[model samples]
Target: MDAIEKNLLKEVAELDSLPVGAYNIRANGQLAGRNTTANIDIVTKTDKPGIDIYIRPFTKNESVHIPVILSQTGLKDLVYNDFHIGEGADVTIIAGCGIHNCGGGNAEHDGIHTFWLAKNAKLRYVEKHYGEGDGRGKQIMNPTTIVHLAEGAEMEMETTQIAGVDDTIRKTGGDLAEGASLVVKEKIMTTGDQHAVTDFNVDLNGEGCSANIVSRSVAKDESKQEFISHINGNCACAGHSECDAIIMDHASVIASPALTANSVDASLIHEAAIGKIAGEQLIKLMTLGLTEKEAEDQIVNGFLK
Candidate 1:
């Protein structure tokens, strides 16, 4: 193993000795790296900090599952740099960002994540971005995630964003092999003058492959959110994509779902809708003796369903 990988293994061993909950690690002007057969949970806070994380299982038929959590904090811009997961590995990763700056300054974060799942492998991943109680911090987050699935592999991913006084952009893509399947769920909630854009794409490259994408967003109080979803069905594959949004009280939202079929035998479908909570529905619920707040909550809940 290289020096960086060895140093990472040592750092992880030290961290594992700590409590099981979440802990913050300061990588101030430091470089961290990990190699095969290493499972780590890391949280970084610094500027231009680098982390090279890799995971690869030992046996061919045997599967190993690794869980990872990444978080960002502080006023300076932090780069939670490149991460890679090898082929034929079962992995679950959760990555999130939170900026709690009471001052009137700005913060920025950038991340890149990549995964390669070999034949007959499975991966479940979740990503979230949230900012709370902002004072004037102009937070910018750019996250790019890519996945490659081999034959008979499966990947399920969910991404959520809640930004206040921040602007975020997220891009994700996946490539599937024969008989592979991929499912993606994206959710965004924005309030207090936030702006966000998200793009998702999936390509099926083999027969009997499938892909599905579902996107939902809620914007309120001058917040703006835009989402674009693309599903490409190639080589006699099947896929579906859907995007939906709800806007309220001077809020704005745009949703576009697109599907492209490259082969004549491929089956693909896409749908998108943008609207607000119906006042008539709320009134009907209120007439049944429910409070106004309760009625409005019910309407919002039903729309999400």
Candidate 2:
């Protein structure tokens, strides 16, 4: 595979050939992408930071990709993707951003995505961010997402960030209406001197609305990571938020989970935890004939999975 293809696979392994409605964005510019099925009126414009995805009611699923890379120093890019889902639709979306910077300057990608889920719709959205380089260049990404769920709508979102992101800040905001639900699962890994911050704010705005937010991360070396999560119940609803992290070396981590209930019937809760690699667990794995590094690797892989 070519460098672009290899880099694409590193973040999205389930994709082989480009799927329908695939929007490919590179460091140089945007590519003439594919057209999806007729059920969904998907459009790609040449002048935008990213693509606009429109889904008709009951339209099929969509898969999208945005990969940015630089072999030299001092490159920056910003991407924005907007999604409009019609009422009573059920769809799954696979989307992510990747970067490969091998130069001496800084390479950055700021992705701003907004989603509107119509009434009674169900959406499964997954995204991953990654960075890799052989040079001393810095890799940075800032992702801001806004979600609006209509009455009785439901959205399940999963986001992951792999290694090599030198600096990153993630922010997500969500609003839910009557009988609507939102679930978010976020995972991250940081090594070396990398720094990362993740924050989420969500509001259950209508009767019977609910939300659950979970975040997990691992920091190694002098890397630092922070997780901030908040959920608000404005009506008679149920909600919960949790944050967990593992620290190693001189790494530092902070977990902050908060929940607010404004209505008399609103039930909300939050929990957070931070810890280091257990020595006894490492010793037990070593007794199985594995080295320290190998044991640590196994533990990390499992935890992230």
TM-score per candidate, chains pooled: 0.76, 0.92
What does candidate 1's lDDT look like per residue over 79-169, in tens digits? 5544344555666654555444445666555666666667776667766665544465566667788888888888888776644437888
- Per-residue lDDT over 141-229 for candidate 2, one digit per residue giving the tens place of the 0 to 100 score: 89899999999999999999877789999999999999999999999999999999999999889899999988888999999999988
Q: How well does model 2 score by local distance difference test?
A: 0.80
Q: TM-score of the candidate numbered 1? A: 0.76
Candidate 1: segments with Cα more than 4 A from true spot: 1-49, 58-88, 163-165, 288-291, 301-305
| lDDT of each candidate versus the true structure | 0.65, 0.80
Where is model 2 more than 4 Å wrong at Cα? 20-27, 45-48, 60-73
Superposed Cα deviation of residue 184, candidate 2 (Å)? 0.8
| Winning candidate number (TM-score) | 2
Error of 2 at 77 (Å): 1.4
Best by lDDT: 2
Instruction: List the pairs of residues colliding in candidate 2.
Output: 72-103, 73-105, 74-105
